[model samples]
Target chain A: MRTMRLNMQNVCLTMVLSLIALGGCDRQATVSTTSVGAASGAPDAAPARKLRIGVSIPAADHGWTAGVNWWAKHASQLYPNVDWSIVSALNPEKQVADIEDLMVKGVDGLVILATESAPLTPVARKAHERGVFIVNVDRGFLEPVADIFIEGDNKAFGRKSAEFIVEKLGGKGSVAILEGIPCTVNTDRVEAAMAVFARHPEIKVLGRQPAMWNRQKALEVTENMLQQYPKIDCLWASDDDMALGAMQAVKEAGRDKEMFIFPGAGMKDVVKMVMDKDPLIPANITYPPSMIATGMHLCVSVLSGEREKIMQYMPRHLMIDVELITPENAKQYYFPDSIY
Target chain B: MRQASTRVLSLTAGGWAPAAALILVITLGFVFHGDRAYFNWNTHRDAMRQASVYGILACGMTAVILAGGIDLSVGSVLALVSVAFSMMSLHRQDSAAMTIPAALMIGAACGGVSGALIAFGRIQPFIVTLAMMVAARGLAKALCGGVKVSRYIQDADGRYIALPVPEAFSRIDARLLGGNIAVVTVIFLACVLVCHVALTRTTWGRRVYALGGNEEASRLSGVPTRMMKVSVYALSGACAAVAGICQAAQLQQGDPEDGAGYELSAIAMVVIGGTRLSGGRGGIGLTLIGVLIVGYIEKILSINNVPEYARLMFTGAIILAAVLLQRRWHPDSEGRG
Candidate 1:
């Protein structure tokens, strides 16, 4: 009882302290503090002097985003003249604040992989309006609010993988898709694949389930699918980890001889299997997570005078082609140093 | 003795509602699809296996709720524990002994800190646990340096194999009793039974109800209210860690994002089991039925090849109906809530 009063008093005190703390921290905190290149805080600067590039990306919560963070850092070292402040925010609100902070700090250019496309468009547009060169990666804004847009084609990835499966089955077979949860991006992949399958009169369209993009859930879904379909000719094991999962279930049930799985996003091990010509491991589609590195490199290049003038004819919207890697060309796509 | 008997009768009465609903769903599926593949042992077992993690975490959440506390940090704890276990396994090739204890300890320590703040620091459980939730996830990200820990796995023959290959650690979520029941399900049931005993037949159990019923009254009556509050959270933390270990074994990867948003499902189980949100009421027997209800619904939907969004909508509808039914039946507790 004595503690309750003390607790109430402490609660009030803590609330007050936190308000003061939040007030003190309204300026925001960022990962990289030291600004390299010219002190752009001053108006005048030399043409050869380096400019500040701000990279705002989603935090490394999973394998892919971690790869993005890794590449962002790696891109910094490659461009010694330019200053890069790579800040990863956990959510969209933090990301918005991050962009505002970068704006306040007067970054010459901005590179962003939006936490989500729509909510981030306004801030991105603001940066573009302020004469800050904007490079959008992976997720594109609703409006053409950037100087350059770079992304792997989700639709192409779906269409090509579906085409490979149909070709392997000689245009007629039972195929089931193990979807990576129902997100806008994954749905694009599945719907495009389904559209292609719909064109083939010989192909039978079985049902699909969301594997939640986790290995264990995919394993369970695959195990259940195996039971439901006695003869599953091909599986769209779309994610690399999901492919690994579905493969495990097939191998355990000794059904590897009958079916092949196509996992995407080119994780190192999966690519290695395709390279070694593992019988069950047929091929994978390449949608590299290192697009952030590409975005970073471009941000530095376009901000510089030489590369921008030389590559003036380059389109503002660049879709990095997604490829299907078989044993023949698997070596070309494999990045042994990739985190994914 | 007489009080205990009436409580048993009340619990039995509460159990019949969800149990009957479950039976109705299973029988309806069979009745409707008599000829088609509307049923299978493997699918049912898979649902049970998947539900085991929820069951274990729900049992722990029940204890905390009964003591007038809520734990929003279980999911983060699960993620943290998973990384801790995998990181340990990396150091010691055969890490079942070391990893299991280390993971559990990390979970308990994290929860203990939250519990201590709520008890001694006089902060609200919601705020304290919420802080812990964010901090624990950040800690998990930091522990693995924000990457999946892919150390090589050692097979049964003492040969080292790469991580993509399923190894002995996968045995944690493997089936027992000739592939009928999963190891996760077994641990879940064991935890449920033990917690059922601890929350019912002990003096501490009585103290739990007293504290939740009226904190001031309980403290005035010489109840060690602070310790009970702290220990319940500790127990919840340990149970979440156990679920994490089972998850790590099942996935064969130390995913930092493992068990994300699992706390909501676990809490849903507790509430759908006829547990009052106001606390001081509910037991594990009814919770078992709640677990089965959710499991059977998901399995039936997936087996029927229902779309993912529709499956989620149905689950939400069924759980909401179950809660409404409980409130309708126990009209007297409605005011208390």
Candidate 2:
């Protein structure tokens, strides 16, 4: 028992020492970067220092968020004048801590894609009060803390997809819905889709099952749904990943000929399927992950562009247009290299 | 003679507990099945397929449990191996012969380290495995750069090229036995068979149960208790690796977040199978029953279109009921079994 206690103490001590060493390295890196910026500013003989923008986003927990991370990095790389510090947090508390650290690091602006709206609003509001320019992306804050808010139209994503499904089915076929994780994004999309389905009294809604925006779970659920409903005419898979999974199940059960799938979120693979005129994936709705790139672009414009001219043109709230991706227009939205 | 007869009676009762829970769950399915979908062979086959991954993990969990240890890192290790296999096969274009063994080694190494820490360092199994869980997930994210590793690869001039998926992926995901069973299901059953034999027929198996039943006595009797613990965890890790490979094949991508929270389900399967958490008291046969019960419940709710919140509540209720049923045989034979 005594030896075990000693061993535990030794392990704890090593962990603490390594943590302190990591902190030291981080501080040194920050100091060096600031010194480099100072040296560059000296040569310009201008009063302006380098613009440091901190980008805080939820960590890439799924395909869509992974695309967000990729786009954010791609946008950051496009601007060399701005010093970009991108931090991804797994949850709201960690995101709050990251924003606080960015604030302490003295960023001129912040581009935030919150993990959750409520828990992150206060910190964003605090940053706003401290005079930091805030550009909030999808999943907006609870309060009006952002200087500019940009979000995709999830309700339209649902309504548009549902309308397309109805029109193709001639307003009479039975449909099943594969839902995403229960959140505002999911709720808005599902409720809107249900409203559209309600208008078509002839359309029999088989059921809606939450596949949690996962490919494996969607495949499993769709397989079981295939066995339950002998003839499903259309499947409204709310996300691209789930759409692909459902498509697989449909193909496996030899029912791809019987139904068409409409998935939102504009995943490149699904868009490609649409481009190829795949029988199963007939259309998709855009809830683009590139919205984060748009948010980053706006932040850079505000911080680096002529302030008066840009402010005159820019709006406080920007809703990126969501469109339908079908065979006719799938090429325009196809991002072959995107991680999503 | 009376005492011996009672012991035999309680053992049989304990053995039958898991099967009873399974029947009860099946009855619920019959009562509220989605328009008789539960009666279909395809539904049962698909349920088995869905349960296979968790079943594979539970195989290792059963072994570790019998040796008086718990492995919470299986889920994260599964994620890590999935990512590793995807990166190798999809991006690096490595053959399955190369990727499979490498992924298995990575998972075994993860489990071996946790086992060593528990056995040699005398840290609690829960804490060690928990630490392994968090660290493995982080490693998975780092390895895949926080994105799923799929078949789309970027070439020079920044254009994406679609590569043909490796043959091994589709093969592992294919249905077999005249399309009645998934390949992954076969792999799961093979794992159960191997674990069952390892736990029942071998002298090493006896040592493991003895170690769980009384560690000091096992050690005094010349059993290599420390090595036994380490091997048990390594076996669990290998099982997780196999599960990861199966997951990547079925999803056709290597998702770093694939197996998040799956450890809880694997643990639940073991416990509901009449396996005592205090250890030294379960078999792979019982775990197989537990897997089916859990799988059918999930399938029934899904086909019935039960909302997400209700599915969660029903799962919790069923787990508690099954465990309570299993507990009935415990008090009578608490002194010895």
Q: Write down the C-alpha DockQ for each prediction.
A: 0.01, 0.01
What candidate 1 gets wrong by more than 4 Å, as runs, is A1-340, B1-6, B32-38, B151-168, B334-337
lDDT of 2: 0.80
C-alpha lDDT (0 to 100) for residue B180 of candidate 1: 72
RMSD of 1: 24.0
Judge candidate 1 at residue A268 and give its lDDT: 81
The local lDDT score (0 to 100) that residue A251 gets in candidate 1 is: 94
**TM-scores of the candidates in the order shown:** 0.51, 0.52
Highest lDDT: which candidate? 2
For model 1, how does the per-residue alpha-carbon lDDT over A1-340 read when each residue is reduced to its tens digit?
Answer: 5566445434533443343233223212221233343445355654554577888888776556777877887777787677566677765544664675566556788999987664466568778888888889988776777888998999999999999988988999999789975545786799889999999989997778888667888899999999999998888888888888899999999999998888888888999999999877788899888898898787776777654574577579888899999999999888777677
Considering only N, C-alpha and C atoms within 3 Å, which residue pairs clash in candidate 2? none
Where's the lowest-lDDT run of ten residues in candidate 1 chain B?
Answer: B31-40
Model 1: which docking level applies? incorrect
Give the per-residue lDDT of model 2 (tens digit) for A1-340. Answer: 6566445434533443343234334434543533345455665588588887888988888889889989987887787677777777765544765675566557789999998665476578779998899999988775688989998888888888889999999989899999987566787788888999999999999999999998899999999999999999999888999998998999999998898888888889889999999988888888988888888888888988775578787898987778999899999999888887
Error (Å) of candidate 1 at residue B82 is 0.7
Specify the CAPRI tier of model 2.
incorrect
